[model samples]
Target: MEIQKTPLKDCFILKPDVFRDDRGLFYETYNQKVFEKITGLKIDFVQDNQSVSSKGVLRGLHFQNGEMVQAKLVRVVKGKVLDIVVDIRKDSETFGRSFSIILDDVEHLQLFVPKGFAHGFITLSEQSIFSYKCDNYYDKASECGIIYNDATLALDWHLPKEEFIISAKDLELPSFEEAIS
Candidate 1:
């Protein structure tokens, strides 16, 4: 696997070495030893989560606050998506900045999202399967998010605003400024 650093500290884009044959292709997703050696950080992912959504579906700009913050390894399982991560760590240099990448089955790319960032994604294919490995268990009380269209962040989802299918809960999330405040 090749670890590509993002502008945000501790975040990375992992490109696995794929092996192909007449039948299909194979690649090692995660190996704790290799991961630790490459990233220099050891994370134990306790929970694995998966979701399926149709094109235009948008989820997140979300994170867990305080002690419940989670580090995640996220990827596209079967389709394409516009994955985004925002550095929300107040003490970090890249705080408030956002990064975006196109993750799809074709590239087999994964993003390593450290505990201090908020993450979200929008499905770009007719359907998509998204999966993630989180280092911590989830807590409802610790859940927090910035609205997808926060003016301060001005994220480009790639798709027009009218094409997005945002949840009522997500649509009601706080703005980037309001969230930090």
Candidate 2:
């Protein structure tokens, strides 16, 4: 497995060594020792979540701030998606900056979105299954997000604005300017 850094501070892209054969394929998705050795940060994931979305569906720019910060390892399981992460740590050099990547079943690539970043994805295929591991347990009070189409962030979700199928809750979230710092 190789853990590569992303443009944002404390975040990374992890690529596992996939072995293929006549039967099928195999790979190790998580190994605590190797991850800590490579990134120098120890994580104890407490939750695993998965969601299915159709093409043109946009999920988030969500974060858990305050006392219950959550870092995530996100990947595509069945199809393809445009994954986006935004740095929200006020003291970091890359604060407010965003990074985008293509995460699909074919590549089996993963993104490590650290505690202080907002994470989200847009489905690019007919149907996509997205999975993630979270370092901390859920805290409803601390969960919040910047609206996906925040003008300041200027995220290009691949699909046009009118094409998106967003949730009513997501639509009601604050813009970047109003997001928690």
**lDDT of each candidate versus the true structure:** 0.95, 0.92
Q: Estimate each model's TM-score.
A: 0.98, 0.97
Candidate 2 CA-lDDT value = 0.92
Compute the lDDT for candidate 1: 0.95
Q: For candidate 2, lDDT tens digit of each residue in 129-165? A: 9999998988989889999989899899998888899
lDDT of 1 by residue, 83-108 (tens): 99999999999998999999999999
Off by over 4 Å in 1: none
Which candidate achieves the best lDDT against the true structure?
Answer: 1
